[model samples]
Target: MGIQYFSQVLIFGSFIGLLGWTITNQVGRTQLQVKSREDWLLDGTGLTIQGILIPLLQATLVYWLYQYLLPIQQGYLKLPLILAFVISFVVIDYLYYWNHRLLHTKLLWKVHQVHHTVTQMDVLGTSRNTLWTSLLIVYLWIHTLFLYLLADPTGYLLGVSLTSTLDLWRHSRLIIPANTKLYQFLSPWLILPQDHAWHHCCKIHNYNYGANLKIWDKLHGTYYKSKNMPSIIGIPSSLNLFQKLFFPFS
Candidate 1:
């Protein structure tokens, strides 16, 4: 199990590195500008202990509930390992689109603002978040439920883990070369740096709220395209760390 887990981690790390390298090499320089050191500390920094802990806590809690509380034994829900991976991936990403959109709503934006508050993009930026947002969000619950139902936690974890690699690439400060095969292959399906860069380009326009693919944004009218993109990204509010950390409530 350890070997398999380590191998998966290695693969994900390599993929992010490859994508990040392509991006950095192609973009000439990172378009994202750092506005303030205070801004960097407040939002730009990656997963703190709290950020990492919350996700793990939520995933584990949901998984354990399904294992012990749910009636899996009443009817066997065993899925072939391969099929489990496919089902988990499809359902999780599909649900993630809606989850991402709802997080932008008036009520939740206070919590989600901690993320968009970052003025620049980096791998760690993807991991930034509030603890309360993690357990309450539909997307995390979907992931936990899928893992518990399939009875193959390994595949479930593998599928969920793949998103981070893609996310890291999307938030990277690098740019994909216009001429690369990987660039061409990844452009249509995955949320590449350019896609997310456009998202952060505006506060209201070009939300581009898809986590994995463009299908949802295209299906809905939220998609925005343009010859110009914003040079800076962040919410309009001027909250400090303490305020942001306890936002929408505290």
Candidate 2:
């Protein structure tokens, strides 16, 4: 319970902090000012749904479903702290790599395309997607499943919080210098802002689908190596507000 509380604080606090930073920074301010009302509607709705409603649904409905299905196995998996962290940060990351790739496929692209509509790297646009898109994301189910199974979920919850925090950071314009030692160390393993920017690029959206790590994409040959930000980001979308919020498909 304590760890869960801490994780919630970490994730929400990061969002608030990033949001404040974005609004205050000159470039971020300009980006926000140029946004259309429809963009705000989509991004605002998406953030509310993904940050609040979806989490509530995950905590209640999905967690309850798991409890019913595995009543006898509640808290059965007692892994070491490091192993549990690895499962969430490494193992599940691999799974999400494929899951993300799957969303890009023709069948699921409509559902996921809303997320790619952001024209720039902004934390506010990170969760922009159709309302029901959360249902297709593996994190909604898998994270709850692991939380239900782990007797001591401290490490796993830490990984989850860190991943959520990084997700926000990578989507924002708060990029680290590539020549810095920090970037040098993290770039080889983690997905940096520039790396994810290319993923949302209008030109090369097919590559860099990994969430937490680049190794998955590198191993699978989907990694797009770029030291600079993409010239053009986001695909053009003609969907109206209603279409974007509910059904993004044409």
Candidate 3:
């Protein structure tokens, strides 16, 4: 949480649409609007609390975990830049895939449900989880831990930036033609907006669990490929902010 981190967030938020994916498949995009200005405020408040504050507070615990339980001497090993970059990307993506899959399980779905409460996918939707749930996100904790121990700042930047870019793009209303060369090139390899939308789809929610790559889903037999849109968006068992924050115990 230094100036560099904020700088990257600012840059990533601005110009996320530079890739021109937001306008594809217009029919599939679901537009959501707030009924009042206060609704927007509430949304912003929730995002800040869960996405920023809680994570910042929990980082102290992560530091302690690193210092005591997971300390490794690999930082001095000085991995090659190219090797570190590729390994970090692969490692994070693989871990994220399984972790995302875990979120869909019956036991874990309650903790992860806040993210699916919104009917529409927007960039802000990325931070829709509750404070406690956000703190426990497998990728946020594990990925940072890996970079802390094994990767230099430069290698970590590439891995984090690439994933961040993919994440922001995944939440957009964009669509890539499944039959086009670009879609084929990126599909089952990179996460396409349509692929992610299916994950949010109520009926087909069990499929497309990969965060960055379709490889894991395919390997685990959860991969689904089709031009169809989901029957509906948003989980049926959605929770309000209070329930989201203190859910199951609320």
Candidate 4:
């Protein structure tokens, strides 16, 4: 329970901090100014659903389901802290890489396309997606499974919190300068903002589907390295607000 509380605090604190930074920074302020009522509706709704409701639903449903199906296996896997963190951070991250890539495929694109409609790299747009899109995301299922199985999920929860925090950061305009030592250190392994910006690029949206690491994309040949942000981001969507929120299919 303490670990769970810590994870929640970490994730929420990062979000509030990012949001504060975005609102105060000049460029971020400019970007926020361009958001229309529709954009607000979509982004706000998405954030609420994904951040609050979906998590609650996942915890309730997955825990109950696991209780019935694997009662004896609850907290069965007792792993070392480092190994548990590695499983959540590295192993599950790789799985999500494919899961994210699969969302771009023809069949699932309709459900995922709403996320790509944001014209800018605003933190508010981080969770913008169809209300049901979380259901398709592998994290909703896999993360819960591991949490249920792990006897001590402290390290695993840490990874989950960090991943959630990074998700918010990557979608925002808060970028690291290419020439900086910090950028040099993190660029090789981590998927930085510029890397994710290209994924949202209007022209070449097929590449860079990894969530936390760039290695998955590099290994799968989906990585598109760039020191600069994309000139244009987000695909044009013709769907109405209702369609975007409920059924994003054309």
The deviation in Å at residue 46 for candidate 1 is 5.4
* Local lDDT at 73 for model 1: 46
C-alpha lDDT of residue 223 in model 1: 70
* Most TM-score-accurate candidate: 4
Candidate 3 residue pairs in clash (backbone atoms < 3 Å): none
For candidate 4, the C-alpha RMSD (Å) to the true structure equals 1.2
* Model 2 residue 145 lDDT score: 96
Write down the lDDT of every candidate, Cα atoms only: 0.62, 0.91, 0.65, 0.91
lDDT of 2 by residue, 168-231 (tens): 9999989889889998889998999899999999889999999899999999999999888988
User: Candidate 1 on 6-28: residue-level lDDT in tens?
Assistant: 63576457555754564565342
* Residue-wise C-alpha lDDT for candidate 3, range 60-146, written one tens digit per residue: 666566767656643544677777667657777787777777887898888877777756666556566655666556655765565
TM-score of 1: 0.78
> Where is the poorest 10-residue window by lDDT in model 3?
27-36
| Clash totals, every prediction | 4, 0, 0, 0
- List pairs with backbone clashes in candidate 2: none
Which candidate, 1 or 2, would have the higher TM-score against the true structure? Answer: 2
User: 171, model 2: CA deviation in Å?
Assistant: 0.5
| Winner on TM-score (2 vs 4) | 4
* Tens-place lDDT digits, model 4, residues 1-73: 8988998998899889999999899989988898899999999998999888878976898778988999999
- What is the Cα-based lDDT of residue 145 in candidate 1? 68
Query: Regarding lDDT, does 1 or 4 come out ahead?
Result: 4
